[model samples]
Target: MKPSDLDPVVDALEAELRPYRDSHHTYRRLPSGGRDRREILDEMRELASREEAKWRAGYSSGAVYHGSADHIEFLNEVYAVNSQSNPLHPELWPSAVKYEAEVVAMTATMLGGGEEGVPTVCGTVTSGGTESILLAMRTYRDRARAERGVAEPEIVVPVSAHAAFDKAAHYFGMRLVPVPVGADWRADVAAAEDAVTKQTVALVASAPGFPHGVIDPVEELSELARRKGIGCHVDGCLGGFVLPWAERLGYPVPPFDFRLPGVTSMSADTHKFGYAAKGSSVVLYRSSELRRYQYYKTATWMGGLYYSPTFAGSRPGAISAEAWAAMLAFGEEGYTIATKALLETAAVIRAGIERIPELRVLGDPLWVIAFASEEIDVYAVMDQMSARGWNLNGLQHPPAAHICVTLRHAQPGVAQRFVADLEASVADVRHMPGSQGVMAPIYGMTGAVKTRGTVEELLARYGDLQFKA
Candidate 1:
């Protein structure tokens, strides 16, 4: 659609969502006087109540991974105790240091590190998966510069890899060579090998890609990088916490961690499968020597001395505390049992998708199930599903939707409800004969715009609505 046509659509969306922005309260700045504590808490509770039902009822995908009442209460107490703690001030709060160190160490061992045969993996706790990836990419860029004397560094990445890699490339002033995946959505070994030039500093693979939920050819990709004497990072942000337990549960999970001789670094989200609260992730390296490049230390600065392991200078120790508590709260057995239930639930959902004649799953995925429709517009199906209160993930390139099965979906009758709703959605969408669904124009604007700046303008305008009172 042209700008004139898009204005109405954007306007309607903005108007409809405006209530969410300024429903009960609108504060551009602090009030003249402090409000009553009881009134503030009640109003905050009222606002939060409007958005809690859908996620709590398992109508969403991947946002709230673990949403049990007991778990939330426990984590809340943990947060309350150490709310003021900061890892930057380790001298003041030594407990934060202990928690951060143990979180990293425990996560390292989880990903086939610190074993007898495996090299000792060492890493620091990052804010989230994006930070971990950025840290790893920067580490590789610096190492290649210092050791190999390569001025212009580059990273060979599969097209299916996370966008964080692209962001890392952009932020670190490196080139990202995108290699297309094969039919099964695994990275082509030959293509990856061919992409590796002298300037290639590192190669990346995803363990169970976010789009298709299929693990890349990490074993081969890492080996290829090894032969080239370059770093190979496994972006396991989505699957690291689940794959180990899946393998232990007798499911076939490929080797995509430090156990592989060529694998140099990995990033895993504690918030996702570790059942920890948000803002916690682990970035692992094969050894401390390699991780040394990721650190930033300055003694000649005017602010006395400064050192930081990750991007942020002063990190929230409370998040690290939550990660530690979650990990200890759920040990190997806990994960194994949860994975068994989660995978079984996913099996049911996957079978349901297979049974629908109009839809075909992209690949054989264990938990994160993505599917497309040849007969109907998949985005229209997404719109219909959204009408039914399903918050699924929509993707381009192939144009599909996926539901990342979580513990919330393992709740009573949630899987059955999803299947029934999905089948109904397909039936509803199958009758539409010709034109694209209501959302076609929006996606068309994304793909059809000649200049990327036009889309950015629309996005910036839309973002402006998010704060309107």
Candidate 2:
């Protein structure tokens, strides 16, 4: 009925989120004078050491893709050299331009950009995947309005597409026509075909979408868009860097990039599989004309004439430097080898989940694997896994849990440990029926509640709690 009614769950969440609140000093206000740099560094290192162990030991899902110590040190050095640089002021930081340009060019080439017969692909690096998707959607919206004289624009997307598309639709005043996925967990092409309308500006596809880690029917969906004379956007934020390598390693990766004539735009995260730092992603278009719509320029301002690309006028150039360095460091061979190991590790995990009688792997996934149970609460199983120090992603719609395999999982015994712990967690959940865990009841409540406004209030209260000093 109210957020207070869920006090027990909220309390547990607070304890987990605010572990350092009581142990560490809360910086409610700045001191009159700055503290010693060494003392500040010591405090920061203490926090970093505590948090780093979780992902370093392969306990997290998709957080640290390439967490090798040497690689991190390299990126840190690169970041340090360019820490003062901003891409917004290219005249002052020409190196930033070079870094960003190389990063985009490398990513585009990897995603079928410069191949013969394909259109010239161009793009800009952004803060992250959300911004990339936002830019692409805005590009489509503006392009449609300018070329087709369409005032109201729409996007036909599978329900499994990333929530960023929904966010873009909400932010840009466009409509998202939802289509259902088939039993294979791929987008239903027929449903998408039917969902398209005269006002539809684009169709959305995913190369291994987030929830179930299954690639959508991109060829069919893109062909449909081609026939309808609309743009098709393939969301590869999670899979872009990994999929090409996986394909070269002989995995069954589908065509889902610029090679598809109808796939006019794409968003890929350098932070995810490209092994860049946390703040970089690339949003690409088939032509410079389409990408120009994502830019902003105005000469009427009080200040000097201003023009900017992507959402932010000023962004850290160090991040782009890190991305460029990471790409060059890995190269094609390094990525192929890494992807092979990742997929192999994922295969082991997927096979282990299949062995567990209570659980079933949701879809045909390569690395990011989701599993669900028809016998018991998957959230309870997830909580049990949490008890064993495993951090996985919880999924709704059909009540599933996932562990996105990173390079950390390819370590010596991580995959084996995952399967063994998962089996033990399922057994624990089965033995203690109705022993609802902290997250299980919360998810149950969220799913059962018809009034979403109550859920939004609960989420807002949770957010407020996060800002508590």
Give lDDT tens digits, candidate 2, residues 339-391: 99899999999999999999989879988899988998898898899899999
lDDT of each: 0.89, 0.90
Number of clashing residue pairs, candidate 1: 1
Query: Cα deviation of 429 in candidate 2 (Å)?
Result: 0.7
Best by lDDT: 2
Off by over 4 Å in 2: 115-119, 443-450
> Per-residue lDDT tens digits of candidate 1, residues 272-379?
999999999999999889999999999999989999898998888999999999999999999899999899999999999999999999878899999987788887
| Clash count, predicted structure 2 | 0
Error of 1 at 441 (Å): 4.3
TM-score of 2: 0.97
Worst 10 residues of 2 by lDDT: 441-450
